[model samples]
Target: MNGRMIYLIGPSGSGKDSLLDSARDALAAQGCRIARRVITRSADAQGEAAEVVDPDTFARLEAEGAFAMNWYANGLSYGIPRVVDEWLSAGDDVLVNGSRGYLPEARRRYPHMLAVLLTVDHHVLRQRLHARSRESAEEIEARLARNAGFAETLMTGESDDLCLLDNSGSLAQTRERLLKLIAEHRLPD
Candidate 1:
């Protein structure tokens, strides 16, 4: 199978990370490589491999040609490091559980990238954010507003450049849908 990059984009609290974790596990069992990102955001304080770095350091690295692409989201700077090119060069399908806003830039850089926009219902998203216990009521409201703004930017009609997945239901359903898409696209070996 030809190497292709899959980039995941969706709003905050949209289960992108959880779904990507499961997808990565399944894909690795099949010998595919899943890519990780570096972020300037603070760690989850719950031991997630956040690759945490201060803003200044992240900026320096970006200036030094360390990142393949860099963008800001939810008030944090995120970067996909240049090492991803090496993996792509070696014929690995790079699975990136990252922001949706990166789609246009990634497409310009990696012509074969498959951009998937995962989504959850507004109620489901609010529930997820509440369960995190990381935000005040006011902060949650602000976050939801920001997500709405991002959603607007992403609401264009579909094309080969975009794939939309609604994830407001069970994990099994979401995984099944994802697997079917990957197979249909011949993205995984």
Candidate 2:
């Protein structure tokens, strides 16, 4: 079996983490591994369930070529550990919660990757972000401004490589769609 990566990309408050966690459990029996991201954010961060590393360690790891794809966004560094590539090579389907800013590089590294972009209703997004309470008002504003461009690209289909999902509905709806997509795109022997 050839490796096929499933990359989930979305902005803050888009429910990417929740959706990924649900799908991870649902797909575990099928041998899918959810790749844990390495981040410069502290472990105490509220929303993202990532492996937190300091700047020095992150630089050392990046210098050692440990990350498959890494990027700086919202003043923080994020990386998908190279172990995901290893898992995929072993024929296990690996799911990654990736960054929109780094999608091009991720595609170049794993062209066959199934990229899923999750979006949310503007009102819902605002509510979710407020509830998360992870950042100051200024930071939240910056995030919304950044997210707008990504949303526009999805609406315009500039990202034809991605399967778009509006997560304004129940999570079950999103999960089933993703499972179906994976089944449809399953690699042939």
Candidate 3:
């Protein structure tokens, strides 16, 4: 059986990292690999475990075909490494921290991949972004606008492959839902 790619996409303050952390812990005993993305931002900027690369470095890597999927979003560069194919071929479910802007291209490239869109309500998103303290008030507002843009852009294309999980209420609830989604796809038929 071919391994699967579970692609996760969400807004900046949607608790993606938190959800991913819980998922990793929950799926630790399973044959799953959660991908660490290559991002053109500081390592600690968003509290996500990503390879921090400079703009020039990111551009060079992109030219070198080091990424399976890559895109520019919110003034930053993000990429999913090419090793994903290897993981999938080896029959291990690979979970990737992905981008909304890159989904169309990503779907074109990995049609079998499971796309998970994690989200929260507008007020909750605002509160979470402010609580992170990583972005200024202006940046937070801009991020909200970007979230709306992503909603419009992501609504098209592959509805069947898309799974939505609202991360608004509590971390445990969202984590359980994510785990079930992963298990549904990860288990052998």
Q: Compare the candidates by TM-score and give the number of the best one.
A: 2
Candidate 3 C-alpha RMSD relative to the actual structure: 1.9
Error of 3 at 181 (Å): 1.1
Q: For each candidate in the order shown, give its overall lDDT on alpha carbons.
A: 0.77, 0.84, 0.85
- Which of candidates 2 and 3 reaches a greater TM-score? 2
Model 2 C-alpha lDDT per residue in residues 14-72, reported as the tens digit of each score: 99889888888777777788888899997777766899999999999999999988999
- List where candidate 3 sits over 4 angstroms from the true fold: 44-46, 186-189
The RMSD of every model to the true structure, in order and in angstroms, is 2.5, 1.7, 1.9
Error of 2 at 44 (Å): 1.6
Give the Cα error of residue 84 in candidate 3, in Å.
1.3
Please report the TM-score between candidate 2 and the true structure: 0.92
Ranking by TM-score: 2, 3, 1
Off by over 4 Å in 2: 154-158
| Residue-level error in angstroms, candidate 3, position 186 | 4.1
Task: Please state the error at residue 100 of candidate 1 in Å.
Answer: 2.6
Candidate 3 residue pairs in backbone clash: none
